[model samples]
Target: MRLERVKEILLQQVEKGKLFHAYILEGKNCDHLAGVFANAITPYPEDIVYVEPDGLSVKDKAVMELQNRLSMKPLEGSKTVAIIKEADTLTVWAQNRLLKTLEEPLGDSVIILLSKNIENLLSTIVSRCIVFTVDEETEITDLEKEAKLQARDIGEMLLRKEKFFTITKKLAPVLSDRDRAYAFLDALQEWYHKLIMVSMGIYEDDSLESHLLTKERLFSAIDHIEEARRELNRNFNVSYSIKNMLLKLL
Candidate 1:
């Protein structure tokens, strides 16, 4: 969902006095969503508590800190909001610990899970929340879907034999400004993961683009993709990051 839509939804929920158990925000632009949540709760003190998943390794400590924030008697509002960005990046131990809180969140508190891939999340974690997908643009036609399928097929064919750079060059323009910058990165990450799976012999299907390639080349390409992703995260020039990724994959 778009930031505006999330704001609208949260406002409506606040008005109705119905707090959500948890909210899973899945998208490429989650930073935008996090900002929107902060903005939505800014006017209403005691309505939001933002958490960072930085170097903290103790999930209980993190949860305790959040609970303490919520424990503060509502200064002016009827609800409390907590946003966890890059939730999927939480360590397995941390994610497991978080499951306890998700199972029984504090009363009148809403927890938001900002993640790109909900598939990696624990089923229990997913079950206790309302899921929101960000990019519900105009419905796709069958032809468009077919073309994407074809593109994916072709892209995979190129990934084989260590031909990452060529596919990057040919397909990069098919993306939009936002997609090229962020969403494409997420897609590339997913692709690299599939390549790892192939290298490990854990994969049998080649329908996904990465699987069409051989394992050795896939793993080699993944290293470069990961490096590019890191550079983007480090606030390196985005245009440079994009170009670097294209050069590596193409």
Candidate 2:
């Protein structure tokens, strides 16, 4: 979904006085956009509270603070809007606390949870709110387009449990070209990102590829790709590091 469309939806909901108690905004630039939405609705900073992660995770304390903020009347508006950035990093305890807050409505206060990876969120919490998915808007070049196809084939090969040698041989060409290799990695990440959305019921694509993205392994697949990226960034041998990643993934 585009940011403008999301804004339109929210505006319509507000106009109808039928706005939801909570919304899960999941996608690229979601946290920034959440701020935009909150600012648009509540000019007063006090009326728009933000609950962000403390260091590495959103602890239960932050969720409690959020609940406390919403308990009060709006400082200067008809409603309050609370935003939880990087909601995917919320701790289990925090999620439980948040779940409780969701069960009890606090005035017309709204909670907007921003998540780049929606799968990390509890399904129960997701069920309680409207979810908006926004894709990254970067334009793909022709080279990148071909890289995506190549990456898709590689991913399918991995899912089919192909022999490691065959998969590595296929990856050789991509790794030989630095640009194409990076583009291929990008494509792979995008594939898992979309499939995750599909599995999570945020996006719909009932293709064979979606079938390949079985819930059993789809959840942890991105971690492998991400580790490969980190290894490459650290000047690790491309072929060796990627092969190791593939081995672990298999």
Candidate 3:
């Protein structure tokens, strides 16, 4: 289901007092799931203590904060809600620490973890949660479509790298927009990773132009790929990020 729909359901469940103690919301629509929860929490501000997992000072520190907040009666009349984003990135100790609170949550307490990949989550945590696959099936569908389209485009470009550079030059219109530029570069970086995996026989042979991204490009710039993501997070210049990554290719 779409994030909007998921949010509606969550809101309804909350109203009915049937909200799960813990939820594992999974899918590519993570941003949407967050939007739903964000919107729902608005009317009941007093009850919810939303924490952006990354912003927490210590690893799993948000859990302690959440437990502390939920320890008391929930804001006079409202129930307590905690939403953690990119939850799969959480350390093992963090999940272990949260197990007890999740298992014996107060009637007024509810926790939701939003993630793209749940395999990284502890099995104990998974078992205690009502897992929801948001875009699981949709990912395969979208990936198939994306593979076909991007493969064809990249194949033509790889054959004539010079021309492709010319095409990318046209992106000047959006080079100034940090968000769009970051997105463009991120996609390129991810595509290169998939290409490396493809070369390693991790991907289907039938996948198009699996050989387009050279192994040199893969190994030499792996560090830059990570740094680019960090740069984007820090709100660095998008055009600069893309240019630096592209330099490694040259």
Best model number under lDDT: 2
Error of 1 at 174 (Å): 28
Q: Give the candidate number with the greatest TM-score.
A: 2
TM-score of 3: 0.49
lDDT of each: 0.60, 0.75, 0.60
Those runs of model 2 whose alpha carbons end farther than 4 Å from true positions after fitting are: 138-250
Residue range 1-250, candidate 1, lDDT tens digits: 3456656665655455444567778887777666665556445745667677667432546766776776676566756777887777766776777778777677766788888877556655755565565664567555445444534554465455346555545655533243354555545544555445344443334655335555445545555555655676676776677666555555
- Candidate 3 lDDT over 1-250, as tens digits, reads 4456556656765455455567778876676665566446445667766666565422577777778888987774566677777888777778887787876878767787887776667655755565555644334454344444443454335435545366457556435676555445434544554455455443333654535556555544444555665677688877776556555454
Please tell me which model should have the higher lDDT, number 1 or number 2. Answer: 2
Question: Against the true structure, what is each candidate's TM-score?
Answer: 0.48, 0.55, 0.49
How many pairs collide in each candidate, listed in order? 7, 0, 0
Per-residue error at 218 for model 1, in Å? 39
Please list the residue runs of candidate 1 whose C-alpha ends up more than 4 Å from where it truly belongs after superposition. 1-10, 37-42, 45-47, 55-60, 136-250
Task: Report the alpha-carbon TM-score of model 1 versus the true structure.
Answer: 0.48
